[model samples]
Target: MQTVPMVKQKVHQTLDTLPPQGLKELSQFLDFLKYKYQAERRTNIVALGGIWQDIPFDVTDEEVRALRRRVTDTLLSKV
Candidate 1:
């Protein structure tokens, strides 16, 4: 199997053979791939700890059960 160093050497050799325009396009492509990779690696989490700090939602147990029931019904209906 090709090791990391071997692969890097091959890449460097290939880069050496590329024309100026080809090198520019390859650099841009590599940058785009890096950006895409970083974007996908991120988690979709937000710290909204105080997003509605002034608002009060005094929810009851019945409300929770009712919401769950409605959600389940909607899902089952779709299925």
Candidate 2:
């Protein structure tokens, strides 16, 4: 029930490239990105450090909620 932009899809596409292990880590990263962007009013450019290198994503508000729902549904269905 939130109004967001449509950049989250781009974030998901970026996420899809990650390995399964990376995907787990990415869930936390996505939450941080969403909070940082929405609360902190950041643009679409987040970085990933360590062996993962630098990963950047451009997420909009709408996409953020949509992707969150999508991921949650997918995960729930699997469980």
Candidate 3:
């Protein structure tokens, strides 16, 4: 298989041969490929964030603090 430098040299040679318009389209295509591979996919997660927001149940700050204190007490007891 061709090494990284060899592959890059080949790409540069190909770029050198393309017309100005072809180079513009290539740049857009490259941007698309990068986004396609690297973009974070948070659609489903963000949708789930509000799924229970409409529910009638709600935990107050005191409830959350009590739970955290219980967890910390347990950990400290073990230590």
User: TM-score per candidate, in order?
Assistant: 0.56, 0.30, 0.49
1 versus 3: better lDDT goes to: 1
Better of 2 and 3 by lDDT: 3
lDDT by candidate, in order shown: 0.92, 0.80, 0.87
Which stretches of model 3 miss by more than 4 angstroms? 40-79
The pairs that clash in candidate 1 are none
Winning model by lDDT:
1
Candidate 3 lands at a TM-score of 0.49
Question: Alpha-carbon error at 28 in model 1, in Å?
Answer: 0.7
lDDT (10s digit) by residue, model 3, range 1-79: 9999999999999999999999999999999988987776635533324777766556699999999999999999999
**Candidate 2 or 1, higher TM-score:** 1
- Model 2, 13-38: lDDT tens digits are 88779899999997899799898879
- Model 1 C-alpha lDDT versus the unseen true structure: 0.92
TM-score of 1: 0.56
Ranking by lDDT: 1, 3, 2
Best-to-worst ranking by TM-score:
1, 3, 2
